[model samples]
Target chain A: MEHSSTVAGNPVHDNHGGTKEIWRTFWILLGLTIVELVLGYIMIGVESTGGRLGLKGAIIILMLAKAFYIVAYFMHLKGEIRNLVMTILVPLSLLLWAIIAFLYEGHSYRNNRNTYDAYTRERSNIQSTDKKADEKGMHEKKRTGAETME
Target chain B: METTTAGLDTKWWNGGKSPFNVEYGKLMMWYFLMSDSFTFGAFLIAYGTVRFSSNGWPDPNAVFKSYPGASETTNAPLVFVSIMTFILIVSSVTMVLAVHAGHERNKKKVATNLIWTIIGGLAFLGCQAWEWNHLHHEGAWWGSNPFANSDGTESTDNFTNFFFTITGFHGFHVLSGVVINIVMLVMTLLGTFEKKGHYLMIEKAGLYWHFVDLVWVFVFTCFYLL
Candidate 1:
């Protein structure tokens, strides 16, 4: 509907050859997508269950492969300028690295909280025992297994 | 007989082919789509990272659902999305045919294919509407400030926030696709593209339609399948 026949900006092409090549590219993309779906499902499923396949690693690999195919074939990035691909990939890589860092930090924070809770409980128990002995109005020595053995 | 030249002509990339045809709008659209893909890709990647980091994320079969009226259990599975996937794929096929007809200079076939494509787009939108309402009514929203349930109970956890935002964005795109298809259909009826003897508009629109389908495939994998 927006056609203009000025031919000022028209890309000259041997339409027959170009069309055939593009069609072939389409078929190849379709085939790759099907393969990806099948393999990706098996990989993700096995990984989700903590199986031998190292699910997370496998998923990351397959996901990258899928992204590569889509960008190269469907998005025509394969034939595009080098700078264009870098423009897309650099930020993506940085974002992924940031996510990994944040996740690890969060995990460590949870672990620290657990450790603190354990130590606090141990100290409270010792204090409570000492207080109970003091309430009896006797100089009750601390129950030491080593003293008993001696 | 024709005379032969002693020398050959040389040109830039695509070898003297059109350098970014403005009228075709193909190159411009490609650039736009590349940027758009990055946007969606970032969302999906962030989702993956969050899901990976989180402890005890819900399983797809256990979480996302088909309605009880449609299925037999609380875990109705991704059957609704599966149907929507098929509809979108079918629409893509019709769109391809429309583009083909445009190349062939077949106006009647172009119109028919456009109509079919529009119908498919509308069907997808309807399905999305249903899925969204179903999810909302099922308390899929983020809970209270402490992220607790309204009744002082613990609800499903916070990863659902990412789920709703990403998928909701995609659904909004689908809604717009429907509107765009309607506009294209109306333009077709007005004979705007009829005299061109080529369905350039359909070709451009197919790029868009296919991109949407392509994005969904990734979303399906990232959100539901994984």
Candidate 2:
């Protein structure tokens, strides 16, 4: 029986598309990042909720594209056998459910807060207060007894 | 029975071989990275949940508008972060080159690329440190947020809390990756792999380095852009 190491040593398994492929992946990743940045920049002036969400969605898609190139080319996952690829990726699909569930729950929580949590709603509506003053007041309260000891 | 047994024997998972056609170490590294991805996924998803639950959040453009040597009044956003993102991408490219050199058994190329990758990692860390320092001066920390919501309404500390925690975690990963690369470079210089007849260790390190870069892509999109 041949050892697994011997099987892994087969030169047939070592064809990982060489340096040209690496450079190509580099360019693709760089391009995707540039697109994402441009989309993000354009999103700044987008006022409508739908418009802003659309740009954010585009940026997210570009970000995922960048991730795909990095994983496929740089990490050499694309060169792996089909079984290996499936094993790594199939489990990752669970993240879709996790994301959807969490975001839904969070959205519901926000709705509940807005309706029932008067303090939260009131606080959120207030104009921005001087946070430094709040921090100073908290510090002052903490220092009341310490000053006498010092 | 003979035909069925023959088919089974020819399968990659026949008792004598690795079904993945990869050595145990590399396969384990892939599994480790998969698990690590979930960890980062959880952090980012939790961040998303918090943002969703909030009524309003700080505009990333307003918060991340400063860069090194820029005037305090300069109103550029996403500029410094874009540079940081490029540094990471370039470092990831160098890491691929290092791994490719490892494949060719070209020790000199491996060492040089590793050095470049290390430099890129450090430069990225330096940028993060500067950004963190700048934010710290403005009173953003784990439990404090000085910035207001985009609508000029009061904002919650969860903004800075998640930002510091997630990015801090990602920075820690980059720091470890640099250390791992330095170790690989030292081993290469010592001809450790030359004696062992393989640079598989460098390939593993490269996987880890690239994983750090991969996490940054999501982090940049989530915190800075969205």
Candidate 3:
């Protein structure tokens, strides 16, 4: 396929070697994917919700490594010139940076929303039910001859 | 060897015989695919941001559960999708075989491998359709997020929207790749590339087919595994 850069009789680029290389990558990808799934199941079974964030990070790292192999070998980008490689990599890195920024901003918003929800729920409960409960406590105190607390 | 003891091969680098050290068609295809990658990347990144933002984001394990002919309440994560992934990967292997056949100028092998790839691609598309129907029955759609799934899990338009959009976009790519494979297969049978003295056309189509497979790996990780 890449006849311009690839020699006609190169071992790995020629007949059996080419197919063998393809199968090898396929196995590696399949194995990595299976490992990812098994780890997910184990974490779920162990009830390790406390370390879920760590597990998520590990999973993502594995995903990135897999992505690299697929692109480098399956796409045949590994043997390309440095310039062509940079042309693809630089933009991808920039994309990653943009995504990271968005993720950070989004997480912050969710945190704020959760905090707001807690505060609002607290205030609403106090208004609707805590008011009557407070009066009942004051009346009991009056009958028992105890001083009313502020 | 194209490279020499003189330190470098300046002949191809000069863009005289082969500019960019790759054929014009192949180079253009790579360029197209690079841009296409950014498009898909952008969609997945957007999905990630929205997912991480939501406190009640639906779990992929729960959301994507269920295989064909299975009840809706089944809890197996990635079972169906794993099969889909396997199919796409097998199609990619067949495409590689086709390119190998081209290298050997075995027109029969090339045509046969291509037909196999086409069958694989079509099977994958059918799988996607089946999966989508199951999802649609469970209340996932183009715009509306159905809250009626059995578990009473909290869902929003964000996750479901991305689910439909990203996979639909990828399904569209599969459709296009299948069409392209059919074209390449026809040309192989007609011996068009043979007359041109090279089966590089098959190799070029193979690149696109492989790329479609590569993108599915990411989609499977993000949408199914994670």
Candidate that scores best on TM-score:
2
Model 3 residue B33 CA deviation in Å: 1.0
Name the best candidate (by lDDT): 2
Predicted candidate 3 versus true structure: per-residue lDDT over B106-209, tens digit per residue:
89999999999999999999999999876665545666554322223334577678888999999999999999999999999999988977888887788888
Evaluate all candidate structures by whole-model CA lDDT and list the values in order: 0.57, 0.88, 0.72
Candidate number with the higher lDDT (1 or 2):
2
Work out the TM-score per prediction: 0.65, 0.92, 0.80
lDDT of 1: 0.57
- Tell me how large the interface RMSD of candidate 2 is: 4.4
For each candidate, report what fraction of the true interface contacts it reproduces.
0.01, 0.76, 0.28
B1-226, model 2: which lDDT tens digit per residue?
6446677537555576767777778889999999999999999999999999999999999889889998756789999999999999999999989888988899999999999999999999999999998777666777777778988898888999999999999999999999999999999999999999989899999999999999999999999999
i-RMS for every candidate: 15.3, 4.4, 13.1
- In candidate 2 chain A, where is summed lDDT lowest over 10 consecutive residues? A141-150
Interface RMSD of 1: 15.3
Steric clash pairs (candidate 1): A11-B18, A12-B18, A47-A55
Cα RMSD of all models vs. native, in order, equals 14.4, 4.2, 12.1
Off by over 4 Å in 3: A1-16, A115-150, B1-19, B147-153
